[model samples]
Target: MTNTNFLISGKLIDIVSREIIKAELEIKEGQIVSIRKKESVPDRYILPGLVDAHMHIESSLLIPSRFANLAVQQGTLGVVTDPHEIANVLGEIGVDFMINDAKKVPIEIRFGVPSCVPATKHETSGFVLDSNIVESLLKREEVVCLAEVMDFVGVVEEDLEVLRKIRACKNLGKKVDGHAPGLKGQNLKKYVASGISADHECSNIEEALEKISLGMMIQIREGSAAKDFEALYPLFDSHPEKIMLCTDDLHPDDLIENGHINYLIKRGLKKGLDLFSLLRAATYNPIQHYGLDLGMLQLGDPADFIVIDHPESFVVEQAYRKGKCIYKDRKVLFETNNDIILNNFSRKSILLSDLQVKPQNGSLHAIVVKDGDLLTDSLLCEPKIDNGNVVSDVENDLLKIVVMSRYDNGKPVMGFAKGFGFKKGAIAESIAHDSHNIIAVGTSDEDLLHAINTLIDMKGGIVAVNNGDREAVRLEVAGLMSNKTGEDLISDYTRLRKFASGLGSSFESPFMTLAFMSLLVIPKLKLSDKGLFDVEQFKVINLFKDL
Candidate 1:
C-alpha cells in the first residue's frame, strides 16, 4: 500500500531513551513507517530536525518565506516565534501576514499570539492586541501559546488587564510565556505562580538555575544583540531537561556568518556535553514543551527529521519535512520570497535644532551601551555645554541619542548615550523596539539630523550618514521587515554596516545594537520618544541630572 518508500540507514538517535541504535528508517507517504535494527554503524546520525525555542522572525529582517530558506540551511526545521515586533507595528494584520507568508514554505513556524501589543503605555506604537484580540487569535489554527508576558510587574502586582490575557490563554489550555529578565527570589516564585512556564531573559547561570528550580524553562539565547549562551550553557549538563536554545533577535548577517540553533549545538559539543542531551535541547525538548507536531522519527509520526554527520561535527547532511528533501549539504531546496515592499510611513523631516539637548547644571543621565548585550547601565556624566546647548562630546565618546515617534505623530526626544564609540557621523534605524520609533545616535546634531531624516525620507529603514556619504537599507514592510530574499537583505544590510564601520563603529551587528537603545524594558537606562527613561526607577528622567 506504500506509494513512495525510502530507506535511510544510520545511527538513529533515540530521543526518549537517549541512546543510538544502528537502524534503517523506512518512510512512506510523508510518515515514518518503520525503524528496523541493523548490524552496521553508519557514517551519519539521523534524528529529529532542529528547533529554535524562541525567536522573532522579523528580527532576521526577512519575511517568513525568505527567513525559512535561511533557517533550514542551519537545520532549523521549526521556530517558536513571538511576532510581537511586527504585531506591535501592524496588529492582527501583521500577525496574519506572517502566517500567510509562512504557508508558502515548509518550515513549521509556530507563532505565539502577541500577549502585549504596544508592550507598554510608555511610548507610541501602531496597534494594540488586547485580551479581546488575544482571545480571538487563540482560536486561530496557527496560534499555539500566549507570547511572552513582558509586563512582569503586572503579573507580580496582579494587574487586572495583564492577568486577564494570561487567564484567557489558561482558560483555553494554552501555554503562557515569560520575559522576566533578571527576575529572582520571591518575585520569580510569584511570576511562575501565574502560569508562565518559560523565560528567555536569564542573563546568568545562577539566575537560570534558580528559575529552573522553580519549574520555569530557561531558554539559552545568543542572538545579534543579547548574547546569553556563555552564561547559561552550563545548563546543558547541569539541567538539560529545563533548558532550550533560542535567538531572541537575529540579523541576516548573523544567520549567514554564525548560524541558528546549530551555532549553540557546536559550542555545547566543544564543551564535551553528552550528545544525547545536546540534541534533545536542540530538537526534542521544544517539541515536547510546546506540544509541537515536529517528529522524532517515530513510526506513524510526520517524517520531519534530519540526517546529520556524527557528534564530532554534527553537520546536518540532509533535512526533511513531510518526507520531502528541503535541505541538503548546506544548501536549502526551498524557494524564498522576492522583492515585495509594503510599509506604513509618512515622511516628516526635522531641523538640526530639534535634535539639541540644552545644558543644565546637573549630572547627565546617559545610556551606557554594551557591545552584544541588551542590558545597559545608567551612567552619570557631566554635561558638555557648547553654544548654549548640551551637545554631544565626541572627544569624550558621549554622543546624542534620539527617539522620534513615527506612529501617533510626535517629535524627537533628545538624550545622551555613552559607549557607541563613534567619533563622527550618525546612525539611525526605524527598527527601535516595542514602539519601534526611529532611534539615532550621533556625534553631533548635524550628523544625527541627517541620519534620522534619511530614514524619514525612506519612510522606514536604517540609515547611516558619515561626513557627506550616506547609506540606507529600507525595511518597507511595517518598517520592521523586508520582503526581499535573505541574500539581498544580508547584502543591503552589510553595506550599511560597512558604511557605519567606515566612520568608527566596531560593535558587532551595529544596527541591531542601535535598535535596542530605545527598548524601555530590559534596561537600566534607555531612550524612548517620551524622554530619557530611568527603567529601574520606571519613570522618564530628564536629560540633565540637575534641575
Candidate 2:
C-alpha cells in the first residue's frame, strides 16, 4: 500500500531547465504538491520516468500487463504503443483487450488507431478496420493517435480511403504516424502533407535529416531486429527536439537481456551525447508530442519519477508511478493476472505434399535477409530440381520459405529465401509481421511441415523442429502475445531461440527475421500469404522470372 501523503529528497535532474539541484518533494494524492530546495540530499538522482515514443507491445511476446511488469523495472512509466499486430488478427476486440489489460497496471499506456488493418491488399488478415472503424476507435478516450500508416504508396497516390483515415485523425486532433522507409523528396513531402507527422523507419541520418526538414519527427529506433539508433544517434546533437526514441518491435529476449529506453540512454551517454538532450528525447518530447498525461516531475503533475544511483552508472534504483512505488531494489512491486486468453487461429496440420513446389521454366526470386535489418533484398537463383519439383539448395544457403493463412485452411504460398543459414531443421511462427500469419523457413519439406504443425497444434506460437526434437513458446493471446510472467516468457523464449540456433541458424534473431518475411510493406522483396510480393512495384509477382 502507498501512503497518500509523503515526502522525499534527492538530486532532482530538471530536463526542461537543464540543471540538477538538491531538492525535497512533497507528494499528496498521487500528485506532486510542492518542491523545496535543500542544502543536502541523498546521493540518488531523481528524474522523470522514461517513455517509449512508439512501439508495438505485442512485439514483446507478452500481453500489455506482463510487458508493464518488466518495463516498469526499467523505469518505463508510460508508453505510446500501436496495437497494429493484434488488430490485424482480432480487429476492435484486440484493441479493447490491450486497453483493458493496460488498466491492470500502473504504467500509462496510450494506444493508437491502427491505420492499416490488413496492412496491404496483397495479404490476408482475420479482420479489417476500415475508415469508419478507425474513426470510431479514434473517438475512444484511450486512443491518442493513428498508428503507423504503412501504405505510403496510397498516400502518395492520393488514395481516398487512406486520406479518409488521416482526415479522421486530424478532425479528432490526433496525430498520424508514418512507416515510409527510404521514401524521399516529393513522395516524402506528399506523405507528410497527408498529416503523417512522424516516422520511425529512417535508416540513416541523411534520411532522418530530410524528414526533419519537412517538419516530421524522427523516432530513432533500436529494436530486436531493425536497429537504427547507431545510424541516427547523431540526431541527439543535430536535432534533439525534433527526435524521439523508440523500439518499434522489441522481442522478449531483448527486453530481458538488455533494457528498453534506458538502454538507449546508456548507449547515448557512451557515445558522448548530451545527457539532458537524450532524456528530453526519451521523456519530454514523446510526452508532449502524444499529449500523454504522464508527469515530468513538475508541480501539480502526477508523481511519476525514478530514482537512479548516479548519472554515470544510470542504474534505476526505484520507479514510482502516480506517487506509488512500482519497482525498487531490482524487483517489480506489482503482480499481473494471467486468466485472460484470446486468439484467432484456425490453421490445421499440413502434409508434405502441401510444401511441394513444381519446377518453373526460369530462375526464382529469393528474399535475401540480413542479420539485424528489416529490409530484404531480391536474389535470382536456379531452382534445384528433385523428383521433378523444386527443392532447397542448402549448400548455397538457399532455402524454402512459405506463408500460410492462419485464419483459414488456405493453400500455402511458397517462395525461396536466403540468409537464414539454417542447415538441418526448420523454424516457424504465427507472429508474422503486419498480417500475423504463419511463416516458416527450412531446408527440408518434412521439417517445415512438422514445425508449422507444432504451431497449429498449440494454436499460435513460435516453434523450432529438427530431426525428431522440437521446442516452442506458446502465445495464446491473439496469436501475438502470452499471458505468462515476463521472467517465464523470457526464459522460454531464450531456450526456444537457443534450440533454433542449434538447428544451424547463425542470425541473432532468426524468428524475428522470419516474422518480417511476410511484411509486404517493407522494401525490395517479401512474401505474403497471397503470394510473393514485389514491394517496389507494390504488387504480388510470380516467384519465377518471366520465360
Candidate 3:
C-alpha cells in the first residue's frame, strides 16, 4: 500500500480488543492501510461502522435505495434485512427486487431468504416461498442467512419444510435467524436444536437469557412496532459478547430524528451501561455472527467506520463505506433514483354490507392494542349491535377491523380492536403484517368503505378517511413500499397520521399499529383475509361464535 488516499485522525475504538487510543489511520484503495498512534487527534471518535443485525427495509415504507440513504447518515454502513414483507406479495421476484435495488447504493444490504411465506397456513398471501424457493435463494451470494422464522410452531415440531430451509442454509454455511416470541423450556430447546442461530423477539429478560444459554445469539430490538430494549438491556451486562442491536421495523421519522445503532448506544449509555459492552453490540457481534464483510477497523480490512463527537450521544458526524466518505455534516451522500414497479394487487369494489356479521353471542374477541407494544390481548367484550349485526362501539373506543385480500377478490374478514380511540372515521393501510392484506379499522361502515376503496384505487397504499376528508400515500411496489422521495413519503405518512388523529384516534403510531393488525403470529386474536383467527389456538373461528 502507498502512503494514503485519505488520512483520518481520531480516538480510535478497537472493538475486538475493547480499547480506545488516539490514533491516525491511512486508507488506500478502499482498505485501511495503516494505523499509527498519535499524541493528539481530532475532536472526534472513530469506530467500526454499525450494522442492523436484522431489519425489514419495506417496513420503513421506502425502497431499498432510499432506506439506505436514511440509514447511512445515522452511521449504519450496512443492514441484514429480510425482504419477507415484499416476498409475501411477489414471491421470488420480491426478494430479487430488494437485491437489485440494493446494488445501486454504497451501503451493504445482506438479504435473507424469507423462510416463511404466507407466514402461516391460516393466512392468504400473494406468494409462497416454499422449500424449493429457499434453496434457490441460498445459492445467491447476496442472500446471507435465512430470515427470522416467524413459524416457531413449524420449527418446534420439526416441520419438514422448515427444517429443510435450515438445512439449506447450513449446507451453504450460512446463519439462520429466529422470531420465537415468548418461547421457553422444551419448545425453545427444540427450536434452537434445529440450528437457529439468533432471535430478535424475546419479550422478557428470562426469555433472552434462556435463548442465550442454549447457544443462540439474542438481538435486542428497538423499532417502531416492537420496542424490547427495556427488558433485554440487562443482557448487555450479563452476556455482552452474545448480544446484537437492531431496529427490526423502524419508521422514517424515528430514523431521521434519532440515529440508528447510534441511537441504541446513546440509550444504553444513558441507562449506565459499560461503553465497551454497548460498542460490541453495535460493531462486532452482528458482523461476527452473520460473517458480514463489514470491517472491524483493522489494517487491511474494509474501511467501514463512522466519526462521532463522543460516546455519550454517539452523534455521527461522518460515515465512510469502503474508505469513501458517504455521510458528512449530517447528510448522506448517495445518488437518488426512485422507480415504481407494480407487483401484485387486486382492485375489488367492496361495500359496508359485505363486512357485516352478527355475533352468535354478545361477547366478541377484540384485539387490545397496547401503546408502544406489539403484543396484543384478546378481550371478550359485549359489543353494541344494530339489527342483526354487531357494530363498532365508539363510546368504548372499540372499533371494527377488516382484513381484505389485496391479491385476489375475497370476502373481507371482520373483527374488532380496542384502544384505537377514534370516535369517527377509519384508517387503512395496505402493508398489513405478514400477509400484507389491506387492513382497516373504523368507527363507521361508511368510513371503512372509503378507506378500503381509496387503497384499492391507489393500487396499494395507506389511506385515512375522516368524515368526508381523505388522504393517502400509494405504495405501488408490492403494495408495501413507495418510490417517492424520502421527503414526500414522510410528508404523506405524517398527513395520513394527522388525518387519523383529527378523527380522535389516540395511538402513538397509527399506521404501523394498523399494519400489525393481521400479524397472527404475535398472539391473542387477529383478523386475516381468510377469517377471524385465534392465534392462541392457531385456529380460525367465526366472530359470531360464543367463547
Candidate 4:
C-alpha cells in the first residue's frame, strides 16, 4: 500500500473534548485516518483549523488566490462564502469564478448558492439567476446551502417564485440562509418557519438573542461597514454554542490592517470571553453545523490543525489545511491562478442632462443609512422644487442618487438622498452592495456625469470625480476591488476618502460609503441601478411621476 499515513504530533486542543493533550493525528488523502497518544516537544498548541461560518471574499477586494494567500497565514483553513457580489456582476459565470478559484487553493471553500442575484427585481444586476440557475448551482459538490435569502417579505407572502426556490433547495436537502433585518414577533416566527438556518445580519444584542432563541445560528459579523462585534459579544458568554464569527464584507485596507478571523478572535478575548468558548465558536460550531469533513483531533480525524505560539495570545505560528503546511511565517508560499476578465457595464458616459433630477410629490420616503450598520433607516424629506420638479439640494447636503441599468435594460430610476454630504463633485462605484450596479451620488451635475463616464472608461471600479478642478481617483480592478496589494489599495482609498470628505461628506470613508448607497436589501431608502426603492414596500417609488 502507498504511504497514506503521516503523523502530525503536537499538543492537541481537541475541540470536541475542550482539552489539551498530546496526540499524533494521522491522515490518508483528504480524510483523517487515526489518532494516538504521542511524545511531543510540547512547544505548540494545536487546535482544529478555524472556520469562517460566513463571509464574502469579494469584500476582501481580492480574488480567491490572494485572499487564500493572506487568510491561510492567519490560521484560517475554511470559509463559508456567499459570492453574491460577483454573482450580481456576472451571474452564473461569476459564481463559477469563485468556485474555480477556491478549487485551486488548499483551503476548504464551501459555497452558498446565491439566493438573491439582483438582490431584488428593482436593482440592475449584471446577471440574473432564477430558480433554475439556483437549483443547478446547489448541486455542486462544494455548495453547502442556499445563500442569504434577502427577500424575507417575498418568502412570507409565499410568492410562488420565491417559495419555488425555497422548495427547490429543500428538494435537494440543502440549508437556507437568512438576511432578515429588524424582523420580530409573528413576522419573525413566520420567517423562521421558512427554513432559514442562520442569520449574520444582527446588529444588536436584542436581535442576536431573538434569532438565537429561534434556533438560528447568529454569526457575529464584524465587517467593513457593519461592525456588530462590540454590540453582541455578550452572546459569547451566554450562548456560545449558537454563535459563530464571520466578516461579511471587509474591504482590502481593513483586511490587511485588522485581519479576518484572527481579528474577531482577539476582539472576543479582549471582551473577556473564555478562550475555550471562543475557539469552539470559531472552529467546532461551524464544522458541526455544515457537516464538513474537517478534523477535530480524535481517534480518526484528518491531521488538520494550527500551531499557535500562545493559545491565550491567539498568535498563529503555522497553519495546515488537510495535513499540508499551507502558510508559515505570515507569508503564503502557494499561489493559484485565479484571475478573470472583469466585465465593464458602462457603455458610454453618463451626462448631467441624463442625471437631471425631477420633483416628487406625495409622502416622500428616503433611505437612511445608519452609521456602522448595513441596515438603513427610512425617513421622510421635503422635496426640492425646481420648475415644478423635485431636485437635489447641495445646501442641505442632499444629493441626487441614480441607479443605471447596465444589464442592457433601458429603464433608469433616479432618486434623491440626503446624508451623503457632497460639497462639490460626485462619487460613483460599480461595487454597489449585493447587486454590483453603477451607483453614483453627486452635487455638481457636471461632475456626476463625468464621474459616471470615468468609471465607464476604466470599465469597472470606484471613482471620485471632483469639481472642474479636481482629479479622478480610479479603482480599475472589478470596479469593486483594486488589483494592487492591500497597502497600495489603502493609499488609493485614502486619497478617495479625503477627496470625498473635501466635497462635504461627514463619514470617515466616502467611496465605500457610497458603494452601499444602493443596497435595497439592507433597509430604509436605497436606489438600485433601477430607481427610488422603498424596501419596506419593496416597490419602486417614482421620482417624478408621483410628484
Better of 3 and 4 by lDDT: 3
Instruction: Give the Cα error of residue 130 in candidate 1, in Å.
Output: 1.2
Error in Å for residue 27 of model 4: 6.6
- Assess each prediction's global lDDT (C-alpha) against the native: 0.85, 0.92, 0.87, 0.75
Over the stretch 1-547, how does candidate 4's per-residue lDDT look in tens digits? 1224565667878777777778766677745676677775467777878888888888777777667777776778889999888888778887887788778878888999888877877765677889988989998888988988988988878787777788888788878888998888888888889888899989889998888889999988887778888998988889989988888887766776677787888877787788878888889888888877677766556667788876656778887666677767876657654345666464566555676655545645666655566666666777667765556777876677767765564544677776767788888877778677777888766777788777777777777777664444454435555455555556777676667667777765566666788888777767776667777777877654343
- TM-score, cand. 4 vs. native: 0.89
Q: 1-547 in candidate 1: lDDT tens per residue? A: 1235788889888887888899998888888888899999677888888899899999998888989998888778989898898888888888899988888888888889888778777888888988899888987777778989999888999998899999988898888899988888899899999999999999988888888889998888999999998888788878889988899899999997888888888888788878878888888889888888798888889889888886566677898998888888777877775566656665489997787666778788888998999899987898888989888898898988889888755778988888889888999988999878889998888888888888888888889998777999888888988888888888998888888897786788778898888878787898888988877887888777665
Clashes of each: 1, 0, 0, 13
Off by over 4 Å in 1: 1-3, 329-331
TM-scores for all predictions: 0.97, 0.98, 0.97, 0.89
> Against the correct fold, how does model 2 do in TM-score?
0.98
Instruction: Kindly list the per-residue Cα lDDT of model 3 for residues 1-547, writing each as its tens digit.
Output: 1223989899999988889999999999889989999999998899988899999999888999998888887788879999999999998888888899899998888988999998998888889889998999999999889999888999888789899999999999999999988889999999999989899998899889999999999999999878899989999889999999999998887888777888999999999999999988987888888888899999899889999899897778998888888889867777869686866987588987897876675487788987778788888788888888788889998899999888888888889899888888898988899989889999988899988998898888888888778988888888888898777888888877777788886677888888887998988778898888888799998676475
Return the candidate ranking by lDDT, descending: 2, 3, 1, 4
Of the two candidates 2 and 4, the one with more favorable lDDT, higher being better, is 2
In candidate 1, the residue pairs with backbone N, CA or C atoms under 3 Å apart (3 or more residues apart, or in different chains) clash, namely 362-546
Q: Write the per-residue lDDT of candidate 2 for residues 225-267, one digit (tens) a residue.
A: 8999899999999899999999999997888778899999999
